[model samples]
Target: MDDWRSQRIFRPVRWRSRYGRAESGKMHGCADLPGRMAMARKAKLGFGDQATTLVARGTRVTGDILFRGSLEVEGEIAGNVTGEAEAGAQVRVLKEGVICGEVRVPVVVISGRVRGDVYAGEQVHLTASAEVEGNVHYALLEVERGARVSGKLMPAAAGSGGDFADDAPTPGMPAAPK
Candidate 1:
């Protein structure tokens, strides 16, 4: 008897977008390049090579945090958050997140409320939902429409060798004397 599996015709698989939308069968096209690049960047940023540490919602952290890879905050951080400058590290603050102290990282993406100074060695992206009450220091800064900043936006000096202390005082702390 002939096997039924041998009689069946193979059909090409169709891919879907992240939201389950059907996509055209074209492998690569100029029309799809931007979306694909954005997806790739998002995936890379969301899930990096190093470990990811999350501060879940409804939680509160009271002390300084020193991390190497990625840190996503959905709750509240009451102190400084620092990351390695050479590790391509990133810090993301969610919409419900709040940081009452300083943030120092290579990359920072904020969609919440930050009440302190932010220092990014590489870039800082402030989404539409982001609200900053203090200054921002970055090599590259992108502020989306509707993002609010109550303080100064300072571009990091070129060839300054990554010193975060030359800017200003930490939130709720005394300024450093010259």
Candidate 2:
């Protein structure tokens, strides 16, 4: 018994209570620890922790939407969708989604159809299934091979103070006067 008490393998068993519960309240083996820690970090950074507003398929919204965290659209929206600038806001339009009005967000991922202008403060990703009929204004833009945009693609000027003006002329149109 003295030899077993000095063994390292018996130390863990000795900490358990009569009910077989470990005093530390920690599991012996947990593969999801890393994933849980990652999620906790994301929550601390004010990202991926906020609730996501979803517009499901077969539904349609007629009024404008103003959000803070994230919005996922899988249906149709006839009005503007806007998110707070510099707030780590994000908007995602799924392949079955459709929007008929302007979209202004810090980050935007589009894989659907949009008939109006899009303004992204940080980045805009147009996936392969995306189709846009209006101009796109972005600080950083990525368009997949099959993505289609019928209007102008403009880059936001540095130090412009986040002003999204429709001053830039499109192709074959007269330039606006300064």
Candidate 3:
């Protein structure tokens, strides 16, 4: 257990290229070190860490969640999630996460799978790994190249009641106009 190879956490690694300074390359005869920009592809709606909550990987929640501050999901949620009335409330779904119900928040950063509608009063940011199967209602939206939204992309004014529940599509019918 004392061996470094048995640790699950990442250890900082620096490798020297042909030049004198440390750069990204193979280390001696071993594999390449972790890149410095490894986290650059992640999603961020700018809510920061005012407060934080975690739904960890391999865990599942069966009921709806109402939260304040930030909720970070790296697992599966079988119900809806909503943020509190205070400002700066947010939700982030990581690459391996999945949410099977609605998400209502001021800010949303999704890099995983969402199977229901999303209402973002402030902003919605979808990364290349995000896959959303339901409608997205947002004041502002940012989508990377590979992000996918199967339902409507509905943009509403900041205060015009964007979280309309009646927007669901009728079975076997054409989608609503944008």
Candidate 4:
């Protein structure tokens, strides 16, 4: 754990609890904190059926990517990504990752480079290593020291009724499940 923290990659804002951990706002230990992760519930399939989720790391994907399940990105994507996670699925962009397009997700933990627009339907987490150079639309946003966002920010657009956007349907804010 000490080595991980010393690497400058284990920053707090870069870490998130899996399985709906953010609702209670309890701080977990590390982004690389290792444990038996809960089994991801198998998502359904079809166009809107919610089957496939993609995570790109150390790779580059051109063109738009549309999926139904959750996506956790740690690489480079050159286009837009549209998907839904079960409340706590995080789209984490590591310091080495670079995204060059629009991102629409429920929760995002950014620690890398984003060259386009970002839309966080639930919350946006910006770590010290994050460098964003475009517009952002988020319901909630958190930025640490050294994090840079050089664009417009639109907050809490869930209730605005625009362009297929809708609020999260959960009764209360989701927290990481124990």
> Whole-model lDDT, candidate 4?
0.68
Q: Residue by residue across 40-84, what tens digits does model 3's lDDT show? A: 322243333466889999999999999888899999999999997
**Candidate maximizing lDDT:** 1
Candidate 3: segments with Cα more than 4 A from true spot? 1-49, 158-178
TM-score of each: 0.65, 0.65, 0.63, 0.56
What tens-digit string does per-residue lDDT give for candidate 2 at 94-118? 9999999999988999999999989
RMSD of each: 12.0, 10.6, 14.6, 20.2
**In order, what lDDT does every prediction score?**
0.85, 0.83, 0.83, 0.68
Task: Name the TM-score of candidate 1.
Answer: 0.65
For residue 3, what is the lDDT in candidate 3? Answer: 88
Residue pair clashes in candidate 2: none
Inter-residue clash pairs, candidate 1? none
lDDT of model 3, residue 130: 100
> Would you give me the overall lDDT of model 3?
0.83
The worst-scoring run of ten residues by lDDT in candidate 4 lies at 36-45
Ranking by lDDT: 1, 2, 3, 4
Counting only residues 3 or more apart in sequence or on different chains, how many pairs clash (N, Cα, C under 3 Å) in candidate 3?
A: 0
